[model samples]
Target: MSMTVNPASVVDEGEFTVRRTIRIDAPLEKVWAAVTQPELISRWFGITRFTGASGAARVGALGTITWPEREPVPVRVEAVDAPHRVSYRWCNPCLGEPVPTEIDEAHSTVFTFTLEPVTDGTQLTVVETGFETTSDPAADLESHRGGWDGELDKLVALLESGS
Candidate 1:
């Protein structure tokens, strides 16, 4: 049987945030690499290109995420804690408009991934915030809510398959 994981999202204080937790049957380091590394990221998420000095998801790093037929979504790394956590601010480009090369706070959101070691593997929680600043907060939140549901499941499958 397939696993079932549900994410929670809320709109409060003018900001929209969605939080999802998944228990991956993989080691913490492996899961961390899958999320932060560009090569591994392409397997489940979009094609990620980090334009930072180290090409790792470090603070101040600028990058773009391009899907099959979509514009390259711009992103800037905001925080990092090695195998534990990483955060970035990116525009909600899933709305189908031209992807901005730079992020504007009023139109961007922050996505944070936090990991914890569990008995079986790792418990990964992703929290995306800062939607209130966007022009279409509710629509953006809804778009990402659906996006994460599929993307996170792909991540889980990727790790579980040992790819």
Candidate 2:
């Protein structure tokens, strides 16, 4: 039995944010690991690598997420709440431009993954905000809206496939 997945939506109530909520047919612990663990995250999302004492996800952890044929985007863990929530601030560089060596506070957005246990599976909601500070707010919002759609779909597939 496959679950219905939802596309991401933009919530612009004076703040530019992209949000998506999906129900994955997997346990909460499995979902949490996919989002918090660097190795697991790299499997579903971009290739993630932390640049500090450890590569684990925790508050203030610095990292980069690289996609094929694209520059590595700098990332910083902003918050972590065990198997519940984890948020990261990442650089959102303009198209064809290289991302900063480190996360640029002035040109970055924060994305949060919030997970909840459900009767048959786990419900995950990703909220990415701070697009108002980007080069093009509308474009970035739409881009990320589509981005979350693809990225989260991979995550659902990875976990639900029993891998």
Candidate 3:
């Protein structure tokens, strides 16, 4: 079955926020697994091709994101509250070949993913900031918008599947 997250469910909005809240038919830990675990992450989002032998997740925990032509984006855990919240910054994040835009001029951006519990399930919010673009604004926005939408959809599917 296809997963769905209604835009109306968005509780708050920020100028820099990408996805406000994604309610999943799963528990906080389940959602967290989908977000953190390398194997589960790959199963859901197709982002992690493989993982280090360390095999653990903790604050300041480092990992790689599998994107071809792009180096594995090293990630450092900024904040962790168990199955509640997970905030991290992507190290040397390749924001898709700087589009000659002001935002692209910036060295990198900060990506934070938060999780909250709701009556239905877990409410997930992913906020990516520091995208201050001038030229090629459309390209930058379009790429991010499409990418997040697709990724969020995948999260829903993965969570619902009980995988």
Which of the numbered candidates is closest to the native, going by highest lDDT?
2
TM-score of each prediction: 0.89, 0.93, 0.72
Please write out the lDDT profile of model 3 over residues 1-163, one tens digit for every residue.
Answer: 6566545222112353344566898888788877767777766554553234344356766566655465555555667777777765553433654322122224444556788888968888887654453234444445566667777887788778776
Model 1 lDDT at residue 113: 93
lDDT of 2 by residue, 49-85 (tens): 8876354598888888999988888899999998999
Each prediction's whole-model lDDT (CA): 0.81, 0.86, 0.60
Model 2: lDDT equals 0.86
Q: What lDDT tens digits, residue by residue, belong to model 1 across residues 1-163?
A: 3554545433344447877788888899999999888888889999998884454577888888888878888888899999899998988565557777788877789999999999978999888998777777777778887788789989988888778
lDDT score for residue 18 of model 2? 89
The window of 10 residues in a row where model 2 has the poorest summed lDDT is 1-10
State the TM-score for model 1: 0.89
Which candidate leads the pack in TM-score?
A: 2
- Model 1 RMSD to the real structure? 2.1
Task: Go through the candidates in order and give the clash count of each.
Answer: 0, 0, 0
Better of 1 and 3 by lDDT: 1
Off by over 4 Å in 2: 1-3, 11-13, 53-55
